[model samples]
Target: MILHTFTLTLGSTRPIYGSAHELRGFFATKFTEYTELHQHNADKFIYRYPVVQYKMIENVPTVIGINEGAEVLKQIFNDYQEIRLGENTYQIVERGISLKDEEFGISDKIHSYVFMTPWLALNQENYRKFYTLKGKPERDEFMRKILTGNILSMAKSLNYDVPGQIKCDTNVRFQKDRLKDVSVMVFSGKFHTNFLIPDLLGIGKSVSRGFGAVQQLKANNEGGSTCSSSSTQGAPT
Candidate 1:
């Protein structure tokens, strides 16, 4: 899953609404919002660069990605485990970075926001189309620059170095590719023993499923999940 953290700048106490699908819908909505404000100029460069936007005019006072999910993810901080990526150690929480909950960081002028997720279905479809096309050397180069640049920029902006890059699958591949995905218990509450995920053996789904699902599950039982794979307890060699 993508690991990201956001501060509740709008207020000290915030609550999250909707599902992963709804959250994705909201991100998609940001695209439209950007367009309506005549901010689509940024999109032209966004998909091809390390920057979030080319035009600074539209950088409104809102958040994107994981920031929207800030309400439902408080206990998220306790889920972290250490991982070896390239040469550095990263705190991996919720299958990604182990950032402090609701903590905000700076990025020059704008407040840098962080968030993460498994590959959404749409993102995967687009990637397959772009990355799998053979003999298109130029397109591949562009993809590498944009995707890698974004990740690198993100790390550098946080004053951290880029470790080995992480690319999560569309929940499906995470399950089928259990040998690659790390296994961690998703503890349900403040208590370490209660887990949202049932078994330690988990795998991301390897198929495409429409929409996404997060939970309203209580500490006693976890709601239905989207899916991932189980792996040995440590970093991959």
Candidate 2:
């Protein structure tokens, strides 16, 4: 699994946790719903996305590729330094372990995990090629197919297992201006969730990515939201 950390602004007092599948599903749904609700087709809103990060704890294996991907991650973390992990957030210099062992005076073997640098992809074919995925009433059934296939393909290319587990923070507010389908899909969940989009206006870089200090939550759960609570649709932002 591509084990990485994500930085976000905390929207609720509740802690957030989920499997990789759940997290991806959470975002994919958010994006799709928002766009559809605004009556925009998925193709129109869909674009090749960045590697959304998730800050990992010490001892978690990190494989940095020796390529463009590595360079991007390096640049990404340059200005960004903190991440919101569930309720607790931290700075990279304080929270981060060495991306490479030598910098930390540790042997490579002791680290075990390879520093997956960016340029390793030979043909440079791998990042992601997310096409405009049209959403329908039966979109849930297609989630596993599109989300699983695409993510797994990237992990396989990077030589990591499918990140079965994923963690994320919640988006404070829902973007109001979008597609009609997006709104329908967004509210069509078991319960309401905090994760939404950056804003009604899609400006700036991906809001999903960042590194900074954050407030922590005391609550925790397996996936989605409350076990028995209905999850509000989390359309991609």
Candidate 3:
């Protein structure tokens, strides 16, 4: 399947300091007509894969649009000249936009990826189950399943039918994090999977707020496996 992706990066005169959630709020409020920007319909949350994701890469405000979201991004690429975040308004000095068609599906080779941001892999229920596991082996296996499910969810959202089962292995460490003032557990690590995912795409929960952004590292030879390295802690941008 060909996944259509659009990325927009904004540069300001000075450093921009804000969370992806704040950045999203700026756009969702400005483009209230575009429900995809915020994934909301009349105060009710739309529970599906988010086509549009907000992020802060290297302290720069970035927005990613997938498939239908890509078209919406194109229509509003030039609609704004400035952005406001928490009482600070920054003038947009540079705008970078990219549109590409990327291959998306199961591959024969195992591809490695690192989480550029924290992966919100567990919810309250899953957190209890995860802790109940006996040892590292059990926990690792559990996380692998979660990772595979994340990939399948993304494929389903894109309407792509997977012909084969996805295989995933993860090397992650748990960390304490907070989401929306609630304490939560997050992971920072790398995983190897047969599924091919676009760079900067997110997985797991609260992805619209920039959690779980992944960057591809390398792809091993077909039918070969690559081990994942220990991941360091990373805070959300």
Note the Cα lDDT for every prediction shown. 0.24, 0.25, 0.83
Q: Whose TM-score is higher: candidate 2's or candidate 3's?
A: 3
- Tens-place lDDT per residue, model 3, 1-237, is 888999999999999988899999999999999989999999998887888999998889999999999999999978989999878999999999999999888887788889998999876777888999999888887787677667777777778887876766888999988888889999998888888889999988889999999998865533223222222111121
**RMSD of each candidate relative to the true structure:** 18.7, 17.2, 5.1
Instruction: For candidate 1, report its TM-score.
Output: 0.22
* Candidate number with greatest TM-score: 3
- In order of listing, the candidates' clash counts read 17, 61, 0
lDDT of 1 by residue, 116-201 (tens): 22221223344455555566454433333332333333334334433332222111221111212544211111111111211111
Model 1: how far residue 40 lies from native, Å? 5.8
Model 1 regions lying over 4 Å from their true place: 1-21, 27-154, 157-159, 162-173, 176-237
* Candidate 3: 10-residue stretch with minimal lDDT: 228-237
Q: Give the TM-score of candidate 3.
A: 0.91
Number of the candidate with higher lDDT, 1 or 3: 3
Give the best candidate by lDDT: 3
TM-score rank order: 3, 2, 1
Query: Which regions in candidate 2 have their CA more than 4 angstroms from the true location?
Result: 1-46, 52-67, 75-93, 98-142, 152-237
Full candidate order by lDDT, most accurate first:
3, 2, 1
Cα error, residue 212 of model 2, in Å, equals: 20
